[model samples]
Target: MNVYISADMEGISGVVHGAQTEPGAREYDRACALMLGEVNAAVEGALAAGAARVVVNDSHWNMRNLRIEELHPAAELISGSPKPFSMVQGLDASFDAALFVGYHAMSGTSPASIDHTYTDAIHHVWLNGREVGEIGINAAFAGFHGVPVALVTGDQMATAEARALLGEVATVQVKEAYSRSAARCLPVAEARRLVREGARAALAQRRGPLRFDAPYALKVEFVNTGQAEMAALMPGSERLDHRVVQYSHTSYVEVYRAWRVFYNLAGAA
Candidate 1:
């Protein structure tokens, strides 16, 4: 089987502060190391489960956090930004399953380490009226291409979010959060072991991909009216209110693309 892994940083083991996820912050280097270890653990687990190919995508901010030299040799890495698909870039119908590593809860999720969905400007996102975060959005993208999301690793809230959206989906919690930037982290060794085992078990179970019925109704609510105004500039989107923009399409992929555009536009606010 072929496997795809999207690695984020906020929910990485031992990460509980914004400084740890920023590129040049003092703790960023160590956070990257922790991210690498968990990613490699997932890759190794996938390999042990008889996967013929495993591709890892740097899904965090800037999309260049993982170093090629430090990655598992058996897996190929997708790094850099301006990727059309962003977090779920390089993903398609060709892969058997997808794994989300080091993901946090959606924006406004209390006690979720570094909680935010895609960007801080986005207050909430809804697909067909159901509120969702990065996990739901990306999972929908994978589902659009017929790939199931099998394993997700992160803090307690992150794991709970995944299970709530993808019933019975496998998850590994590396920390328990007391606030957005405060968590009781697991030992690095133990966290890696849990991630590895979670990947193996999830792939072995092989659940079906999440499929949303078309046409898709995508709505994004920004933190402020200014952000929504900027997002409303997208040719095909509608400003539903002072802080929400709505877009629709018959295809989930198009909706996903529009989502990227919406947020990028909102970033200007």
Candidate 2:
């Protein structure tokens, strides 16, 4: 079976500060190492569980955080930014299952470390009035291509969000957040152990893709009114208020495309 892993950084073991996730910060290098360890653990787990192929996507800030030389030899890495799909860029129907590692919670999540939905531009996202985070959005994108989200690894808040939206998928918590930039983290070794085991079990799950019903309605609440007003300028997107824009699509894929436009516009804020 083919497995896809999308790796972010803020939710990695021991990561709790913005400096650690930024590309040039002194702690950033260490953060990358931690991120790589979790990813390799997931890779090892998926391979051990009999996956024939595995691919890793670097889905954090610039989308190029993973150290290529340190990546598992068993998986190919997709990195770099400006890709149309962003976090779930490489996803398609060919993959059997998708795993999310090092992902954080939504913006404004209480005590969720460094939480934000997709980018720094937004406060949160809503699908059919249901508040959804990055994990949910990416899972839905994968599902649109018929790939089930089988596992997620991050912090306690991340796991809670995943369970709430995606049901009981396997999960491994690297940390428990005390606030946006503080958390009680497991030792590196223990977190890796949990991640590997969780991955192995998650890949064995028989769950199907989680698809949103068609005619998807999306509401994106931007960081400010200017961003919202800018997003509303997009075709078919309507300004709901000073900070939210509403967009509808006949297909999930279309909604996703519009989502990209919406956020790109919002990111200017």
Candidate 3:
């Protein structure tokens, strides 16, 4: 099996505050080490389960969080950013299964650690009238290429939302959020054990794409009026109101691409 993993940082065990996830924080180094341990565990578990190849994408902010030098020898890493697909950049039809490691809940989700879809500039993202976060959007992108999101690990809300969106698979809850910036986390060792086992079990199940109906409508709501105005500048997007812009496309890839544009422009504006 060829497996693709999109790894984010906010939901990693022991990560709660902005300081833990972003650069310049005192604990950021320790947080990065924890992230590498969890992700490496997942990679090791996948390889042990008979995977032919495993590709790990450093999908966190700036797209460069994982320590490439310390990554598992059996896995290939795709790090750094500005890729067309963003979080799911290296994804394609060739992979047999997909895993989201250390993903978080969407904006406004209660009791979620460091939760936000992409950036603070955007409020929420809706696809075909259904609200989704980074997890949902990335799962849809993977599905577009005929891949199934087999497992997801993160905080309580993160795992719950994944089960809600992608149906029952395998999940590892590394922490339970007490607030947006606080959580009751598992010890690093226990978190790694859960992730390793979860990945192995998730891959053992049958693999299939999480179907998104064709002719998708991608809508984004920004935090400010100017952001929405800037997003509406995109060719196909229609301004629904002061803060929201909607774009329609028949292809999932096109819809995803438009979504990327909408968020990028909105954030930069």
TM-score of every candidate: 0.99, 0.97, 0.98
Residues 110-211, candidate 1, lDDT per residue (tens digit)? Answer: 989999999999999999998999999999999999999999999999999999999989999999999988999999999999999889989999789998
Model 1 misplacement above 4 A:
none
lDDT over C-alpha atoms for residue 179 of model 2:
90
Could you give the candidate ranking by TM-score, starting with the highest?
Answer: 1, 3, 2
Task: Compute the lDDT for candidate 2.
Answer: 0.89
Residue 48 alpha-carbon offset, candidate 1, angstroms: 0.9
Query: Taking the tens digit of each residue's C-alpha lDDT, what string does model 3 give over 1-269?
Result: 99999999998998899877777678888888888999999998898778999999998877777878899988999988798988898899999999999999998899999889888887888988889999999998988889999999999999999989988768899999999989999999999999998999889994677887878998888999999998999998899989999999889888888888888898778
Leading candidate by lDDT:
1
Per-residue lDDT over 1-269 for candidate 2, one digit per residue giving the tens place of the 0 to 100 score:
99999999988988998888999998988999999999999999999899999999999989888878889998999999988888888899999999999999999898998988877888879987789998988898998899999998888899999988888788888899999989999999999999999999988874888778877899998988989988998999988888989999888888888998988877775
Off by over 4 Å in 2: none
The TM-score leader among the candidates is: 1
* Between candidates 1 and 3, the lDDT winner: 1
Error of 2 at 79 (Å): 0.8
